[model samples]
Target: MTDRHDHPAAFVDDMSDRAEQIADAAMRLFARYGFKRTAVDDIAKEARIAKATIYLHFKGKDDILRATLQLLGQRVDALCREVMEMKAPFAERLMALLRAHHCTAFLSIGAGDHFAELRAVIDDIAVKERKAFESIFVRYATQLIEECEARGEITLKRPGVDPAALITTLMQASVGAKVGGISYEDYEARLGLFAGVIIAAVLP
Candidate 1:
C-alpha cells in the first residue's frame, strides 16, 4: 500500500540516475560487509554523495535494497525479452534463454566471493520482491516451452513434463551450481548440456 512516489522528493528529474548510483554503491557495500553491517553512511561515502541525497530517491535502506533487486530483475527480464524476440528456431531461442539465465545468475550471484552472505541479506529484506521476480522468470520460461510445443518444435515425451516444473528444476540446478563453487565456464557448459538434454527429451 505504500506508494514510492508518495515521497516528496521521489519525482526529481535526475532521480533515476541518482537511484542507480545509490543502488550500485549499496550493492557493493552489501556484498562486502553484508546488509546488516552496511549503513546508509557507508553507501553515501562510497557513492560520494550526501546521506540525505540517497533518501531523495529511496525511503531507507530497505527501499534501496528493493530498488537494487528490481534493477537486477529488470536486467534478467530484458534478457528474457531479447531471447523471445530473436528470429531463431524454438530450440535456439530456448538455448539462448537458458544461456542468458545462467549469465545473469553468474553475474548477480556467482561473481562475488561473499555472494552467499549477500544473498542471505537480500532474502531477509526482499523476500517478496525476489519471489515475484522468480515468478516472472518462470512465466517467461513456461510461455516459451508452450509456444515450442504448439509450433511442433517440441513434443512432450514424458507423461507429466510440466514446463513450469521443468523451469523451476533448471533454476534450482543453476543455484546449486553456483553454491557448489563451479566456475562460470563449467556452469555454462553444464547448463548447455542440460538444455540440450531437455530439448532432446521433448523433440519430435
Candidate 2:
C-alpha cells in the first residue's frame, strides 16, 4: 500500500518525520506521567496515530523511549552542523555548539522530577542512546577545535595537548559542573567559565 517510488530521500524523510512525531509525543508523556506509567496507547493518543501505526515505526514502548533520546541527539547534531556553516567566529560558534548539546538536553528532559525520571528511564533502558549523544558531541566538538586550529584561530601551546584530549577534558568538566544540584542559570554560567579555561591558552 506504499507508493512504488516515493523517492528514496523523500521516503526516508517521511519516515523520520513520523517516527520523530511519535517519539516527541512519547517524551512529553514520559516527562509528565513518568516513563513507567505512560502506556503505548497514551503515546498513540498524544501523537494522534493508531497504536498499530506506532509498531510500524517502533518495536514497543522501550524502543520509543530510545527514539525519544535519539531525537535529542539528532537535534544537537543538526545544530552543530548548522553552527559549522555559520560565518560566526570560532568562540561564538563553540558556545553555540555547547548550548546546542547541553541546553537542548536540559530543556528536553525539563527540570527536577521530570529530569530525574527521564534520566533514570534513559539509564535503565536507553543507555546506548545516552552514550551515543556523548559520542556525537565529542566527535563534533573535537572537529570544531581542529577546524579552529587549522584556521589559526587557536594553537596548542603545549606539546601532545591535542584537540581530542582538550575536548574530553572540557566535556568532563562540563558534566562535573552539573553536579551538586545547580539551576539553569548557574549551569550556563559555569559552562562559560569552564569552556574559557579549557580554551584559554589555545586561543590567541
Candidate 3:
C-alpha cells in the first residue's frame, strides 16, 4: 500500500543516511592517510560516491576534516558530561572520566602516526572554537575537583590549590599515556598514585 506520509519522511531519512555515509567515509580515509594526505578523491572512493557527489555534501577535504573533528569533540564533551552527571562517588566519577577517554572514538582515531595530524588540525581551529573546547575540559575537571574537595578527599594549603592548574596538570598527565609509549594500564596506575598525592596535598 502506498502511504502519503512516507514521501517526506523517506526523503529526510535518505538525507540522513547519505550524510552519515559521507562522514563515515571521510573518517576511514582520514584515519588511514591523515589530513594532509587525504584527498576528496580518497573520501569519495571510500564512500563509493563520485567526486561530485562528495562535493554535494562537503565543500572540500578541509570541510570534511573539520566536520569529522567537530563530531569527535562533541562526543568527547558528551562523555565527559555523562561522567559528571553520574550519581557515583568522586573517585568513581574520576574513573568514569578516565574510562571515557580510554575508550572514546577520538582515541581510536588518534591512534597511529596520523594522530599528529589530528593534533595539528586541532591547533588550527578558530580561537573561539578552541576556547570553547578548553572550557568544556575545565568545566568537567572543576566539577570533579570540587567534589573531591567537598568530600575532604583532597587537602588544600592555606593559599589553596588552583583548580584550573590542577585540572590542566591532570589532563596533560593523562595524555602522556597516549602520545607517549606508556600503556594505559601503567598510565592509569600512575594516575592513581598522582591523584592520591594531589589529594593529600590539597586536603585538610
Candidate 4:
C-alpha cells in the first residue's frame, strides 16, 4: 500500500517551487540517459541551476528519480481518472484508459528509446513508487469493467471470469504493444486493438 508521502497527486505537491523545478529537470535527463548515467551536475545543467541548488531540494540522484517517477505517476493517475469520467460508451472509455495509462507513458519516455535505461533502475530504486501507482491503475480498470457489467452495458461471456482478470490480460498485452521498433501510433493502436479483443471476448 502507498503511504501519505506516496500519494500520486501529492507526491510533489509539497515541494518548493524550486525543488519541483529541479526534479522536473532531472526527470527529462533520466528519461534521456537512464538513472546511472544521469548525475547531479547533469540534472543541474538540465535545470540550468547550480549543482549545489539541487542538494537543497534532494539528497541525491535516487531521490530525484523517485520524485521523477512520482511526477509521471501523477499524470497517468489523473488522466486515467479523467478518461473514466468521460460520457461515452464503456468500450470507448476502456480504450481511452488504456491510452491514458500505457501510450502516454510510452511517449513520455520518448517512444521507448531509453525505456530500458530508466526502467531498469526503477525496479531496484523506486519499486514502491511504481507499485503504488500501478495499484491505483488496476483499481480504476477493475472498477470500469465492473461498472459496465452492472449497467448492463456489457456482460462477461464466460462465467467465473473476474473483471480484474480482464485487467491482467490488458496489462500483459500492453507490454507486447511496446516491443522494439514500433511507432507511438502503432503502440497506441495496438492497445486499442487489445482492449477491443478483451471486450469482445466478454461482450454479451
RMSD of each: 5.0, 3.2, 3.7, 6.4
Q: Residue 109 CA error for candidate 2 (Å)? A: 1.9
Where does candidate 1 stray beyond 4 Å? 1-11
Comparing 3 and 4 on lDDT, the stronger one: 4
Question: How do the residues 14-133 of candidate 1 rate in per-residue lDDT, one tens digit apiece?
Answer: 578788888878877776676778899999999999998988888899998888777777778888998888888877887788777666757664555667866676688889877876
Best by TM-score: 4
Per-residue lDDT of model 3, residues 1-204, tens digit only: 976467998977876667667777887777677877888888888888888987777777766766665555676788998888888766667767765654364344655667667667857853444456556666887878787778776655446477777777766665554565444466567667656655555656
TM-score for all models, in order of appearance: 0.83, 0.81, 0.73, 0.86
Worst 10 residues of 3 by lDDT: 101-110
Clashing pairs in 2: none
Candidate 2 structure quality by residue, lDDT tens digits, 154-198: 887677767777788777766666666577778778788877776
Error of 3 at 62 (Å): 0.9
**For each candidate, what is the lDDT?**
0.77, 0.80, 0.67, 0.80
Off by over 4 Å in 2: 1-15, 179-183
Candidate 1 yields a Cα-based lDDT of: 0.77
RMSD (Cα, Å) of candidate 2? 3.2
Top lDDT hit = 2
Better of 2 and 4 by lDDT: 2
